[model samples]
Each structure stands twice: as structure tokens, then as C-alpha cells.
Target chain A: MSTRELKHAGLNLQQTDPKTHEEAESRVFGFWVFLMSDAVLFALLFATYGVMLSGTAGGPGTQNVYEMKSAFIETLLLLSSSFTFGMASLAMKYEGKASRISVWLAVTLILGLGFLGMEMHDFVKMIGEGATPERSGFLSSFFALVSTHGLHVLGGSIWIVVMLVQLSVFGVTPAVKTRILRLGLFWHFLDIIWVGIFTIVYLQGLTP
Target chain B: MNQEDRAEYRRELRSYIIGLIAALVLTAASFATVHWRLFSAPTGILIAIYLLALVQIIAHFRYFLHIDLRKSARDDLQLILFSTMIVLLMVGGTLIVLFNLKSRMF
Candidate 1:
């Protein structure tokens, strides 16, 4: 490599040639822009949730519907998945074996699915208990904020699946590597958003 | 891979591990604080949880996202900071205006 761009870019973008490095760096930078915009989107949703916090309309609110056990478990699952994705990224960078990277990716996928399953369970139970989104502005905004994050995770999980296919078919090409880098950013970004959810939405919701 | 390559790989792996552990601690602390009602005042608990979340978010950005103040990553950092500014403005403005209007109405 002409420069330590790979190392500098966090070891995930391991392009060798100068031209390839420059190109990948620019694309990754562009992906950063996309993520920041997504952050803005989520922030506004959070704002909406905050403003609607008291519009429960005499219906069930956070204390009535939220299960701390499940929320904490979901948080752990997502956090672990982020770590696994980081492992997968490292394997992609260093390990010559496609199998190794695929293994870590599969683990990350399972953790992500586990998270989605728990969240789906939570939503199902909430609705079953008459805590539907239509119940109040509060519940509406709650579902809106939380489900949007869930959808992002769902999308990221599908991206992981697609990447697995590409790894098998294309075998770690620069293009595939670039895609992986962006996906890593997306995955970790979701976890960051989860921090906000668990803190602002769940924890804050639990407060008196 | 050379010896140096192996060393670098190990170092990278260590960073992820560190991030994971730190995150787990912060997550547990936030949950515990709420679950146990560690603070008598609701406001105190809220501030504690938010502070924990802030620190954990920064850790994730540094260790997992590999965002630092390094010159190479400076552009990405600027993008994130600028985004934060916009988010603050929009979210902040929305809350201020709406809450003020709510107060006036009631």
C-alpha cells in the first residue's frame, strides 16, 4: 500500500492501490454523510416523541406497557451484535479465509435477528394489551420512533445476508470490501441510535 | 501475514473488545439505575441515565466506529459534528416552540 489509508480509515477499508484507496475513502465519506442525515431524521422523531410524551389520553403509557426485562435483554443483544459485526470487519481485513468472515457475519446476523424477535415480541404484547399506536399520541410517537430504528436494523440484517452471498460469489473484491465498510458503519450507527432509544425513550419513559 | 501484520490484527481486535466491555458496563448501569430507582428525584435519575448514554455513545463512535480527532478521520468527524449541530437546532427548536405553544394553550 502506498499509504496506511487502510489503517487510518480504521482497518476496515483495506484498499491497496492509491487510486483504489482514494476512491473507497471518498465513497465511505459519502456514506458518512448519509448516516448523518439519518441521524437528523431520528433526532426529529425523538423530538416528536418527547413532545407527545404526555398525550396518553388516559390510555396505557410506558409504565403500563414497557417491560424492563425485555428492553434490557434487547439492548444487550444489539450491543453484542455490534461487537460481532466489528469482528466480522476485522476478519474481512486480515483473515484470508472467506469462511472466517462468513462465520462472524452469521453470528452477527443471528444476534440481530434475536434483537428483532424480542422487539417484535414487545410490540405484539403491547398491542395485545390494548397499547396500540392509535391509542394515544404518546403510543403513536413511541411506536414511530422505536419502529423506525427497528426497520433500520432489519435493513442492516438483510444487507448482511446479501454481503454473505457476495462474499461467497465475489470473494472479497474491493467493491465487496467497500460495501462491507459502509454496512459496518450502518450497523454501528444503529447501535448508537439504540443508545438514544434505551436512554431517552425507555429510561426516560420509566422515570416518574 | 507478517509478524507486524499479526500484531496489528490483535491490536484491532482488542479495541473491539474494549468497546464491548465498556458498552456493557454503561448499559447495565443505565438499566440498573432505573430498575432500582437509584435516585430519589426523577430529574436526578434522568440526568444520570442521559449522562451514561452520552458517554457510551462517544465510546461507540471512537472504538466501534473508529471516529477520532486524527487528521485522516477529521473530515468524517466534522460531518458528524455538523450533523449534531443541525439535529440540535431542529429538535431543540421543535421542542421549544411546541412546548411554548402547549403552555400558552393550556
Candidate 2:
């Protein structure tokens, strides 16, 4: 297929040789499927959180525990990380030097770590205030949903580090290229989930 | 990279920039709507917030995920839509049944 014809979901795979390109195409598609299933998992968690919103059992509720400023900052961090990951993908595709890709990925990793730190801080403050997950169903579900997303960010950060090492060792082979593309999808996907969390958990919590 | 590749790089870069700007705007607006009490009622604020979030999600899907209605991208789109449907069914049913039972018991 021509380059134009090879242009499809996730990332463009046409930069590789034909054999590797074909392999990467299916692999990226499979990753997309995995992402969708993961979406369903998050959706269920969201639903559970929604159901338990009223079950605070006299513990700290949304307004009492959530700080909008912190959540907003976290949102900014994750969103910027998503954009940075996009730049990494671009560097992978267009730039000859692997250093460019590594730079972008490093920036993204920092942003991801920043997000995790802020979220953990929020959790720490909430728990310090006696809003532990064991305190109520609401807090339990809230922790479950938000922490799952946080763990995903943590996992993505580790993947970013691994990809950095792979880039040094493999030097942007078709395999490494496809892996980075999949990483981009995962990173961006986490940002999308954060959008949901800030909207439903944070914004909705502060609505009243 | 060659000139054409550089041009393509700029194009993709533009998409990411656009996505970032759109997401920032949406997120800021959502927070501002609540912080400033833009809407007098809680329901109004919730609706406005959710609508903005929906738009931002679509923006992420388009620019970040590279999902569109193009023929080449349709398969992934279809999978996402299908997953969304299943999610709605499962989550919606859970809510409906649980809330119904809660009302009956209490």
C-alpha cells in the first residue's frame, strides 16, 4: 500500500519497511482494542462512584475533601503531558535523531510524575483529615476510581522510562517505533480518563 | 528529514497544538463555571460542566487519538462506539437496578 493508504489509527506506520509496517499495523490495532476494553473498565468504576456518591456515612464528602485548585493543576499537568507525548510521537516519525524523541518523552515523564505527585498529595490530605476509604462507601469508590487512573499514569511513566532505554539500545527500529506509538496512545488515553475524573469527580463535586 | 517530511511534521504538530488549546479552554471553562457560580442552580452547573467535558473528550479523540470518520479510521471508531454502547448498557442497568432497590428498601 501507498503511504496515504497506510495512514490509519493510532500512529502512522508507513515509516517502516513493508514487513515491519504490516506487523506494526495489526499490533497498533490490537492495542486500540485493548484501550477500548480498558475504557469499559473505567466506565464501570465511574458508575460505581456515581452510585456511592451519597454514601458518605458522615465522613468527609466531596466539598470537604476535594480542593479544586489541586485538581485543576493536576488536569493541566496531564493535559500537557499528553501534548508532550504527541510531540514525542512526531519526533519519532519526522526527526532522524533519537535524542529529540527522548527529550520529549522525558518531558512527558516529568509531567506524568507531577500529576501523580499532586494526586497523591490530595489523597494524603484527605486521609489526614480522616476521609479514608474505609470510612465510607463514597470515599471507597472515589478512591477506587481516581486511584485506578493514577496507577495507570504511574504505569505509563514506567513505560516511558522503559521506552527511553529501548530507544538507546534499539535505536528506533520498527519495533521500537511501534512501541512508542502504542505508548502515545496509552498516554493520551490516560489524559482522556483524567478529563472524566475532573469532570465527574472534581467539577461535579464542587458544583453545589 | 526532507522538506516534505518537515511539512508533515508541522501538520501533525498543528493538530497537537490545536488539541491542547481546545482542551485547556474547555477545562478552564468548566472550572470557572463552578468556581464563579456562573450558573445559579446546581443542575445548570452540572449540565454545563458535563457538556464542556464531552466536547473536550471529542477534541482529544480527534486530535490526540487521530480518530475520525474517515474510511481508514473507521474500524477503530467502530470498536470505540461499540465499547461505549456496552458500557452504557452495563453501567446504566446497574444504576437503574441499584437505585430501584434502594428506593424500595428505604
Candidate 3:
């Protein structure tokens, strides 16, 4: 009759032990594992950085034109978006209000879009400034590494829009719930990678 | 879960937020030195910032991730350690190969 007694009884049914929320929690665990794997991809890039840093040749080095202020703005935008995503996930889980969850997701999507747009703009400006990948080995690797990340963010934003559409038409069925659960891990994982970029590429690029 | 456990989770969440913010601030400060030169060699400063940034990233994994180092159970810790080792081998191995090729080629 009591809560403890109920839980103990619930445990007897292994299949029914975990509620939908409990199922969702395990997805988070799986996502963490995925992030660890993705970290390896980044580690490869970092190693590349270590190797090719001095390969910049006599061409324009990082500071010859990496606008620190612009980089800062981009960093702030991405970091703030990460917080917005946290808010969205929390709203979805705790509030269980469909409309509000969508609203938070929309807000998160907008911020995410803004971050990627700025990055794209930055890439164009860099190229226009004659800092294209063909200029040097360093530039080639920089473009490859940084642009891959931007593309990932772009992909994630598109996925968000698709999920929003799903939530409205189908409502939060078990499938939709599980998808959101996995996406939460993914969105946060990207944010973690962004933090790495903001530090290694954006911050370090300004030095010297 | 019990009230005590929920409260502990909340505390953990707060600590993660604090740590993340501090990392962000230090990260920004490290590079915001564009207006002034704290170090003479750009290469040295760049490497220093990169190393620091890596530390900040691992900090996020530890706190926000809840991947406890103390794995009284086999599943979580074993998975994490195995994955980490594999990743390290791949990345470190790639670095050696690529850099050597880079040295020889161009």
C-alpha cells in the first residue's frame, strides 16, 4: 500500500519495473557511451593539430587574421545554445507539457541555427581573406576539422525540425519519446565538442 | 528514488553547472588576450591554450557525464575504460602515422 511496498512489488515484474522515464534514463547512459566514441574522432583531429601546426608555411598564420572578437561571439552563441538545449530537455521531462516543450525546442533550434550561420559566415570571410585550405597544409586541416563540426550542427538542427513535426502529428508515443531521449544525448554531445573547438581552435588561434 | 537520493542528484547537477561555467570563463580569458600580449611567442601561447582547453573538456565529461570512476559494478566502468583505451590507441596511432607522412611528403 505504501510507496516502498509498491516499488518492491513492482520489482517483481522485471519487464514492468522501469517506467517510460526509467527507460529514457537508460538512453542517456547509451548516449554517454556514444560521446566517448566521438571523442576519439576529435582526438584524431587534435593529434592532427599537433602534427600540422607548424606546417602553416609562410602563409597567414592563425593570428595574421583570426578575429578574436568574432570568435568570441561565435563561442558565446554556441555555449548559450547548449544552455537552451538543457532547458528544452528539462522542460520536456519535468513539465510534460507538449506545447511548452515544442516552444523550448524551437528556441533551441533558433539559437543553434544562429551559431551555424555565424560559422558559415566566418568560413566564407576566411576564404575571401585568402585563407582558403589550398593556401597551406595547416589551412587545409583547419578547414577540414572545423567545417566538419559545423556540418554536424547543421545536421542536428535539421533533425530537430523533423522531430518537432513528429511531436505534433503523432504526439509523444513511445517511439517519439525514445528518439528525443537519444537526441538529448546527441545535442549535448555536440555542445561538448563545441567547447573543445572554442578552446582549442578559437582561443588558441588568438594566442601569439 | 528517495528524497535523499534526489537531493544528491540535484547537488551533483549544481556542481556540474558551476564547473562548466568556470571552464568557459577561463577558456574565454585565455584567448581574450588579443588586445594585449601576455606571451611573446604565438606558438607557445597557442599550445598552452590548446592544452588547457583539453582539460576543460575532460572536466565536462566527468561531472555532467556521471560516469563515476568508482565502478562497484562491472557494466559502466568496464565499458567506459575499454572505449577510452581504444580511442586513445586509434588517435595516438593516427597522429604518429600522419605526422610521419607529413614530414616526408610536404
Judging by lDDT against the true structure, name the best candidate.
1
Tens digits of per-residue lDDT for model 3, B50-91 = 666667666655544434454322355576678778877887
Chain B alone: TM-score in each candidate? 0.98, 0.94, 0.65
Candidate 2, clashing residue pairs? none
Off by over 4 Å in 3: A1-33, B1-20, B33-35, B39-51, B69-81, B96-106
| Pairs of residues clashing in candidate 3 | A208-B42
DockQ of each: 0.79, 0.80, 0.34
Which lDDT tens digits does candidate 3 get at residues A24-84? 4465567657767776777677667656777788897877757777777777776666556
- Which CAPRI tier for candidate 2? high
Q: What is the C-alpha RMSD of each candidate to the true structure, in Å?
A: 1.5, 1.4, 5.2
lDDT values of the candidates?
A: 0.90, 0.89, 0.66
lDDT of 1: 0.90
Give lDDT tens digits, candidate 1, residues B18-93.
Answer: 9999999999999999999999999999999999999999999999998887777789888899999999999999
What tens digits encode model 1's per-residue C-alpha lDDT throughout A63-137?
898888899999999999999999888887877467988999999999999999999999999999999999999
| Model 1 quality (TM-score) | 0.97
Residue B99 of model 3 has an lDDT of 74
**Model 1 misses residue A123 by how many Å?**
0.6
Interface RMSD of each: 1.4, 1.4, 6.1
